[model samples]
Target: MISSFLLPLLLWSIERILKRKQFGWFIVIVTLSLVNNFYFAYYQLLTGLIYFLLELFFVINTIFYQEKVQSNVLSLPHYWH
Candidate 1:
């Protein structure tokens, strides 16, 4: 029982360490893992899908925005140099 709580906490700490370089993907995986484990082992559905959906949206937005900026940079002359 105690390990169950400790497990997610440990995974969460690891996820935090990787946050800046791979923010959304890590969060999604960790959150989903926690949700699955807790649900299957403890029969608890903690945390709402709304928050997950928001994280997904933010990730998508960030990717799209970055791509747009890259494309704009490519369009400028001498950008490759």
Candidate 2:
């Protein structure tokens, strides 16, 4: 029960801090946990899927938003010139 929740968070946190760029892989494993739930785990597929998708969205938003911010920062001086 608890392990299911903790496992994904552990993976996501490690990837987020270490590789950082490839944190999407954490989402993939968590998504697989959706299937794992159906095989007698305490949670349901919907719960696992929802959690995975939420985490995936957060990771993607972080990466893409940082990219946009960086590009805008780079372009700031160009607009004045």
Winning model by TM-score: 2
lDDT of 2 by residue, 1-81 (tens): 544564656445444645455666555555565555635333543454566577778979999999999999999999999
lDDT score of model 1? 0.55
List where candidate 2 sits over 4 angstroms from the true fold: 1-44
Check candidate 2 and list the clashing pairs.
Answer: none
Any runs in candidate 1 off by more than 4 Å, and if so which? 1-46, 78-81
Per-residue lDDT for 1-81 in model 1, tens only?
443464455445444544654455445555655656655433322332344456668878999999999999889877765
- Full-model lDDT for every candidate: 0.55, 0.61
